[model samples]
Target: MKVVEQIKAPILDEMETFEQKFSNSMSSKVALLNRITHYIVNRKGKQMRPMFVFLVAKMLSDNEKANERTFRGASVIELIHTATLVHDDVVDDSNMRRGFFSVNALWKNKIAVLVGDYLLSKGLLLSIDNEDFDLLKIISVAVREMSEGELLQIEKARKLDISEAVYYDIIRQKTATLIAACCSLGAASVQPNSVHVEKMRKFGELIGMAFQIKDDLFDYGETAIGKPTGIDIKEQKMTLPLIYALNTATDKDKDWMINSVKNHNKNKLRVKQVIQKVKDLGGLEYAEKKMLTFKMEAIDILQQYPNSDYKSALELMVNYVIDRKK
Candidate 1:
């Protein structure tokens, strides 16, 4: 079986049930909205977020049985996450996502924006109506962090001089925060007043940190792990490898790298050269080391949990975050 399938084995029933709940959460009275949501549901990715929710919930629940709140939490997360992606496609003017045409590409930006808003409201109402205040707090904070992270990256993009510290801050808010919410929500759904919520949140944050670093590494690698190699340079996104390369480079080389990113970003040759420079500077090696560090820390967090299918699946997920090709 595929690794994702393997990781999902223990939670197969919950995943299937969650899918129905997720579909119901997206329902609307308007036909157009229904059509669009149907499309979105059909084109869904790996559903890793909900998997995290169920795995953590089941692991921590009294009888290894995830309750109704767990399903609702997972649905709320996926709903809000989809809302963000729709808005992101509009903002980035992206034509495709996961090999399918983006919502903006199909319905135009105005409709896409409205759809995003609708999804956002649906997610929020799901929590508010259910009085899942603690869960809402967790997801709300993540959304705020995501918006801040995106804006921060835009501001830093202008400078092209992001420090390693700033770089970590960006990814933590941008990518890690949502996954952290997932794990925390997982624990919260099962045990409202337990410290495991915080523990799982930190665990998920480590996995998310490693996950984003792995994504950054793909930009300099020969393999296409969700995007083209050197695309980060072409788009002038300051990833960890490039940041490390710039920090350690001589004044002349550093100046050249910045110039290439700022001005020659569109030129294929210059982008390739920049990728090679980053590689030669041990940028990739340094990033891989950091990625492993997060992975180990996440694994260590699980050391306190006893042996079980849920814990085992969670471990597989941590490794899969760094090991998956795309």
Candidate 2:
């Protein structure tokens, strides 16, 4: 079966219910707000964060039934994630998202910011209304970490001095934290067993790390995956591949790279040169090795859980994280 089918087959019903809950959670009385929310909901991507919540919940729950609390937990995570994406589009000045015009693009920056704020508040209120404090705590930490990661990346981009260690730290906070929260929230919604929650959290973190690395690798590839190749370089974002290549390059080569990223990144020739340098220095291979290592670690964590269809689906998701082209 295709990876997506394998992951979704076991949780089809839960996903349908989660979708309803998600839409309901975002409902607004104001017409413009409602329209924007509807547009955002309609253009939603794979819903992978909520998928993690359901998959981990089922794997950890005794009866494997996703209760109302599970659906609420998933809805809360999705709201927070959606809010972040809206704000991210604004901050990046991006006009498109997920193959559609971004909220900021269609509604302008002011409305987009308000929409993001509305989504964030709705998520917080969902947790409070449901009295799901544990889930709120998990989601709150993920939000904080994601914010810190974005700021850190922006700070590092100005200097283009990101170390391999700093690169990992950035991705962990920016990307992995949310995924980790999804797994922990899933386990919490089911049983609140610390052991189970921590295990799934770690498993999700590993895969999340792998997922970001795979995204970084895409920046160096010849094919376009949503965004153009070397967009990271153009933005002066020091991703894993560039970090690796910069660390191994000679003084003269490093100077050229630094200059290219800092000044000439907009030039297609310079960007291509940067891409070629990363390839020539084995940056891509190094990143792939690290990504696979995390993928294996996530799989090992799954092995500790009892065998179930949910477990099998989670395993497939780990494979998909690295294998997905976009």
Question: How many backbone clashes are present in model 1?
Answer: 0
| Leading candidate by TM-score | 1
What TM-score against the true fold does each predicted structure earn? 0.97, 0.96
Misplaced by over 4 Å in model 1 are: 222-228
Candidate 1, run of 10 with poorest lDDT: 220-229
lDDT of 1 by residue, 58-130 (tens): 9887665679999999999999999999999999999999999999999999999999999999999999999
lDDT of 2 at 7: 98
RMSD of each: 1.4, 1.7
Candidate 1 clashing pairs, residues 3+ apart or interchain:
none
lDDT of 2 by residue, 252-312 (tens): 9999999999999899998998899999999989999999999999998899888999999
Off by over 4 Å in 2: 222-228
